[model samples]
Target: MSGKSSLKDDIYAAVLDDIIEGIYKQNEIITEKQLIAKYGVSKSPIRDALIELCKEGVLISHPRYGYEVVRINEREIRDVVDFRILIETGCFRVAAPTFTKEDIEELKNFTLNECWWNGKDELPALKHWENNMRFHLKLISYSGNDYCYRMVENSTGLLTRAYAQRFWDQRDNRAWNIDIEGHLCIIRCMEEGRFDLAEQELKKDIASFLDIICPNYARAVDL
Candidate 1:
């Protein structure tokens, strides 16, 4: 990437992290100058990053107040998980029929390779999020439906927002342990050609996750 483009991406990640970490609350104003100083960069990259974030619905631009963080609501949180369930379960129904031992091995390797799912928060918060994304995206892709894959990618940001809020608010070992176990359970169900069982486990997993992340999700996303 060009230097300016790379800088823009860096600033974008940093700003997103700050917002996710509750460094800035919902509707909090963020100035270009503040970001420039914080990132030690020029206006061009900061502006680019903020504009992209605005487009992503993570932030909104205000003529009077620089930029404001998004306040995600309970409905939006439910919608993300509900939508994910719809897409993912459908994928599992189809994908499991063709699921192979090698596929299971590959996915197992992928999620467990750099993850801290054994005990607790041994994994960094961001790494845990990334690991979840990898598993979900791969699960959908195995269905051989490109559209399902893309839809999950597009809609997953809401969960990311919610997950980040919980992580920033509290890092619980139990949560991580359960999350990893849920993934493993689904994989095993798929391996056994028990697609129905896989779907049930997935629903249970999502419900458990939503319980911890929602209602309180606005605490991190809103003002």
Candidate 2:
């Protein structure tokens, strides 16, 4: 990427991050002129970033309103989570048998560090969310399925931001404050070569979040 393009990508990422972090709420209008002034960039980068956001379903453009943040729905949230569970659990189960002791230890360390950083007041929620995403993506990367890995990576950016924004908007709870003990449980099950239990735990973890975000679907899935 050229220097200008790289800067544009950075601008795009920063704007998306702010939107996903709920700094820009639903139906809020944003303009390229404002962004151009805020980021001290030209219209090219600002326009490109807005277009990218539009493509990701994060923003909508109208003739009268420039661009507005998209409102999330229960159906979209549930669908994303369900898709994540299917792809992630499948990846984990397939890769669990191949994980080395070193691999497991690394995962354990990452989880612990996340727990530690989560308790620190200086750590921003966005950083915690990013770390949480990295931890899961790293695990799935081990599956050796390049295509699946890329798909998850791409879908996760948009889905995670949407889920996180809605979650924080509805509740004051911190994302990092989640019960990561479930992660330890998953790691232990994988270490013991108990793939079935690991899969079950994974489903439970995903289901718990689904219940919070989309209770009706969670109940339906349980039934």
Best by TM-score: 2
Q: Candidate 2 — number of clashing residue pairs? A: 0
| Candidate 1 lDDT by residue in tens digits, 1-223 | 3599898998898888887777876667899988888777788999999999999999989976699888776778877878888888878787776878898888878767754446556766666677777778877788999988988898867677766655555444335433587888987886777778889997776666566666355344444
RMSD value for candidate 1 = 4.6
What TM-scores do the predictions have? 0.80, 0.83
The per-model lDDT (C-alpha) reads 0.76, 0.76
Off by over 4 Å in 1: 1-4, 114-118, 169-178, 215-223
Q: TM-score of model 1 relative to the true fold?
A: 0.80
List, residue by residue over 100-204, the lDDT tens digit for candidate 2.
Answer: 989888888877775445454566655544665676787788899999889878877766666666656755453443456677788898788787997889777
lDDT of 2 at 197: 94
